[model samples]
Target: MFRKLIEDASTWHWWREWMLIFLGCIMMGTAFVFFINPYKFVPGGVYGLGIVLHNIFPSIQVGTFGYMLDVPLMIVALLVFGGQFGARTVAAALFTPGYMNLLTRAVYPNEAAVESLDPALLLNGQLNLSDDLLLTAIMGAVIIGVGQGIVVRQQATTGGTDIVAMLLQKFAGIKFSTGILLADGAVVLAGLLVIGFGLGTGEAGEKGWVLTLYSLITIFTTSRVIAYVLDGASYDKLLFINSDHHDELRRFIIEDLDRSATYIKARGMYTGNEREMIFLVISRKEVRQVQHKIKEIDPRAFLVVTDAYDTFGEGFKPFPSADVMQAE
Candidate 1:
């Protein structure tokens, strides 16, 4: 029994998901401590709110606020999503904030360290600052986005706004994307008022609307990066094949490509001849195989390939489940 347990723990499949989750959380925590939190850059999430609150209450660490906020959200997730919410997600939600706190202490040990990095820190509750806001926004966004994307891909989350988004979707019938936009948008706008505008009271106040604009840039960059990382690049290709050898091409697609196709009948504009056209969505990598096979079957086959996004269904991403409301 002991050896069986040990063997199970040693399996790559058993450990891979947890390892990735831990790494993803660490990456996200590093982004927040070293980049986002230090700048008061609100990229929109619970952590964004934590940044605003931390500015108001300097004694409290942002990650502590994150932990406080996440607990209730995790409860919401458990109640709404049931067992599908899973212990791993709960672990992620709890660990990320604590990890962020650890990183913050490690990276920015003292006021002197903060000031040495960016004098902007003097104004923002002794935060470690960056010289270039644009660079910080871009780099932070990429790291955080990729980290969050990896966690999400592993069927877990760091909780926070993800739970709220799921709640909105569950009760209000709002779509996850729209719910996320509303929730994150509200946080970012609130950050603009609380941190960016600052009521002419602090360093961020002096930075003014520019800080809000930078936050917007960060949010946009983060969203793009998350989408790119979560959705494989291969899924972007949509192939249109007009082939005389429909049977042969279809057989190749079914047997070799192991993909499905939709057929539509249309008449040629100039020739006034009716023809059957095959439409299929495939990964970019499979385009070459399809092309070669079509050439072998029908040299004169007309082929058109276009970029596509949000491809969901068989052989691709399924619709997001309530439990899988991914977080940033």
Candidate 2:
């Protein structure tokens, strides 16, 4: 059964890709409807601010508003970035609002206050101290994070902030992590202004601030969790080994450690001697095994190991950071 499932998943067809895309959309919609919308929380992105704007004016639907806002951003991204980027974002932009609208329409009549209002205990008094603001934020963030991780795995997106982040990274030469932080930070700050501080006083404007804080906390937590989940648990090290017994070392790594290695030719700068160099990327967990294998094969091998960041492709996927881990 497991083998069949794996085989089914490995089938590289349009239907499979579409299935993943649809699943990603549904997960994103659930996050918006069940958690974000219910709590009146805004995530980091254009959609976050759109929710706030729509909330202020009940006449405006969040889905429609979000779509309209993202349209221009998508255009900008396409113009600034490239056709592929624009195309990818366009799918997300269209699908996100469509899903949100569908969910909103379907759930509109069933609204009977999913969350209750009680001043004594926060979050409707259902969640205890153990599930306090911090915990709620962390859990919510994690859920969002996992959803996003899955989305990325499928090579799709939830649009809004993701498009902005990618555009900034490509055009401005900004790092993806930094771009995401900046984009999300702006939305969170806007949320703070609109939501007001919910600091026990229960002032008219204060609840909005409280909600804003909650949303920001949730996004921050989720982002961290997503990062960690995509990356492996350990910081990987890239090793370049040069030794007389290259074949022996390679065999040891392949057979004992079950890792593949690449060989390249290198020449000494001063000695003018050409030698074969072996390079491998290994997880921290396997470092000890690799070291032992190398020692057993050839103690005189010249090995250089360097820390690697965010490796992708065969052998491993990206792992989420502490923040991302907490999010999921």
Candidate 3:
């Protein structure tokens, strides 16, 4: 019985999912502690609110505020979404903030420094771009986007404004994307007033609008990264090859590249000669390999390669469910 339990724990799926969560939380933690929190940029989400609240209450770290917001959101998600969420969602929500707190402390010399956000401590003073908020916005956005993407890829949703977005989708009949934009926009507006316009903080609001602009840039950049990660982008290429060495190239593809190809009976439009055309999909890197091999095999071969955006198959992304495809 003990060995059986151990074997079940050691299964590939169990470790792989946990690894995703662990790595993703680390990414988010670093981004919050280093880029987003220090600058008071409200990039939207509970953490964005965290930054706003942290400005008002410097005693509490941004991740601590994230913890404060996430709990209620998770509870609401549980009541509303029910079986839609699993352990991974709960774990990711609870873990990321605590990790961020740790990172904040680790980087700063003390709590006072953390609150002040001393420039020298942030990213070893290499990324303290106080004078360059635009670059910092982009950096934070890309990091957090990739982090959130990794978590989402593993079927885990961090219970932040994602829950609010879904709630809007459910009760108000708003689209999910629109709901997210509205929620984040509200947060950004809140930041503009709280931190930018100087509502309830010690900071001055004279130059707050500029930070608001940078916050929007962060939001836009993060969305692009998340979209790239979720959609997998156009990293793969589709190719069609017509060459006398079809058999040899096919063999190379199968044996060397360990990739499969399809053969289509074709006749040239002008020549009217019948032959087998090699059709295949491969990654951008593998395209160069195929090109080099083709050149070696038949210098005069007719080959065409094009971007294969969002390919779904055995080696690529799995096909979405029927409902998802229909929505697409």
User: Candidate 2: where are CA atoms >4 Å away?
Assistant: 1-12, 80-88, 108-135, 149-156, 197-210, 225-235, 238-281, 290-307, 310-328
lDDT of 1: 0.76
lDDT of 1 at 74: 85
- The residue ranges of model 1 lying beyond 4 angstroms of the native Cα positions read 1-14, 83-86, 111-129, 169-178, 200-204, 243-262, 269-272, 285-302, 308-328
Clashes of each: 0, 21, 0
Instruction: Identify the superior model by lDDT, candidate 1 or candidate 2.
Output: 1
> Which portions of model 3 show Cα errors greater than 4 Å?
1-10, 82-84, 121-127, 166-178, 235-317, 322-328
- Determine the C-alpha RMSD for candidate 1 after optimal superposition of all C-alphas: 4.8
TM-score of 3: 0.70
What are the Cα lDDT values of the candidates?
A: 0.76, 0.65, 0.81
Question: What digit string (tens of lDDT, one per residue) describes model 3 on residues 64-100?
Answer: 9988999888887677655546477788999998898
Residue-level lDDT for 300 in candidate 2: 84
lDDT of 1 by residue, 62-170 (tens): 8888888888878777776666555767989889998987666666647454334233543353543456778888888889888887887777778887667667866
Error of 2 at 146 (Å): 3.8
> Which candidate number maximizes lDDT?
3
Q: In candidate 3, which residue pairs get closer than 3 Å at backbone N, Cα or C atoms, i.e. clash?
A: none
Q: How many Å off is the CA of 38 in candidate 3?
A: 1.0
